[model samples]
Target: MSFAALGLVPPPTFCKKRGIEGFRSHLSLCGVVVGDLVSTSVPRPPGPVPSMTPASRRGLISWAELDFRAYVFGAIRNERNEFTDAFIKQLRLRPDKFVVVSRSETDAGQWLELFGGDQDETFYQMRSRMFEAPMASFNNRPVGHGAWDNIRMGRDVLYSTGQAGEMDITGYLRKLETERNEGWLFWLKKDRFKVKYLLILDAQPNRSGIQLIQDVAWAAMCAAGYVRGAYSIQKYVKATDALLQAKITERLSWLPPSYALTFPVSNHHNALLKARYARYQA
Candidate 1:
């Protein structure tokens, strides 16, 4: 099912002007937060939108987290058109199961707490709750001043998880090396417990932000025996639907140098550890 099936339509105020050029400009405005954070312009001219080959598209889900209602209402109708059929065919996932995290819920603290709690909560439940959660006044800029949608969804949800230093896992996401704004997706397990794939749209993320996601993702993968004693890791970037896998060898400072990789601590936590170690040495 397409976004149309979801009965979600762009608001009346959606850009009145039509055509690819207008949508491209709207996409640029939608990326204001990202551009502001990274101090770079967004949505380079809408040249031919790239397409992903069948082989590269395998194992990826066609999903995106919901933007704040205001942005959703403002999205141009044409933007709702998705290239998810291939993504679904390859992954064999249902529309609901092929879910994206949403910006509709601002108070992700409670959701994170409950989900992170020891109590038994399935991924299905988490997805369901995210879909059902209420939307709030999350747009930083006034409507019409700047666009809000995909980029805003990722920014809002990630920041609300206390990734912005309010609670634990504090650090801001740095700009990825690409010019295009991204759509988010995931690769969840068949059991629907652990997250097997984290298809973030941004490349060249901040060191700390990448570290945070890596640590959490590694923890989950380790719990599920997805990683053997020694395993290699590869990074990828999505060009349109294409998943461009990279072949490079650069060790992350926080990650252990040994072949057997270990999780890294946050920069803040690492500093505390260093201080305590120095005091102990004294």
Candidate 2:
């Protein structure tokens, strides 16, 4: 039913409850990080509010003023190539245009650097000056061919950017050419399932972005492997198999599947799953 149809009115305050759950997630997407000290425009509709865009109630404070340590910390594992090579590169070119650097020679083991920190006050003052918002971090590059291409990565190659070429396309096309020259994909029964999968968290519900920030940080921690073995509930439950069902439900229902952080939703979970996967293991 329409909110207005029922004569519902909004609160005096505005910009507090615009989006449903993706608010903090959007901040992460925008690359705002821990301790960056920025403000969020959480709009609270005056009356029966209508839909709004992200820019509607541009926050009085800019999140750029806050710290970004935790988000960078969460990126450690993905940067180390533990998650997926593609993911490592994709992060470099995120839309938020966050700046990252590799502290060591190992893969993408770099931390984030916000450009606004130096002039945080200015960033907040210029909130309305969207067009000229100076970046507050390093590597102020744009997305290009691969992963880090968009962001300002020192490297400028497709491989480093996480981009692909005709060969990649050709390989995908060739996968369709069956041995019989048929235009269908064919795989052994064993190949139908993945050997393993990684669950990563994105945005979350509730909070003034603090809770979401912490949750995202924790998820990133798992993604970065700082909280090693956290990706697998089985590993933790091996010591004691209590509250297994509840844990699984809470995790799945909490976030979107696309951003659903998982604990190795293994086929070995319960008796039914075990029975179905037992023969395959043997």
Identify the leading candidate in terms of lDDT. Answer: 2
Clash count for candidate 2 is 45
| Candidate 1 per-residue lDDT over residues 118-137, each given as its tens digit | 13312121110011122223
Model 2 scores worst on lDDT over the 10 consecutive residues at 197-206
TM-score of each model, in listed order: 0.17, 0.20
Q: What is the lDDT of residue 164 in candidate 1?
A: 41
> Which runs of model 2 end up more than 4 angstroms from their true locations?
1-72, 75-84, 96-102, 105-282
Model 1 alpha-carbon drift over 4 Å, by segment: 1-78, 88-121, 124-157, 161-167, 170-282
Model 2 residue 167 distance off true place after TM-score fit, in angstroms? 50
- lDDT for each residue of candidate 2 in 94-153, tens digit (9 for 90 to 100): 423222332222324322222212222211111111111222333442211211112211
* Candidate 1 lDDT: 0.23
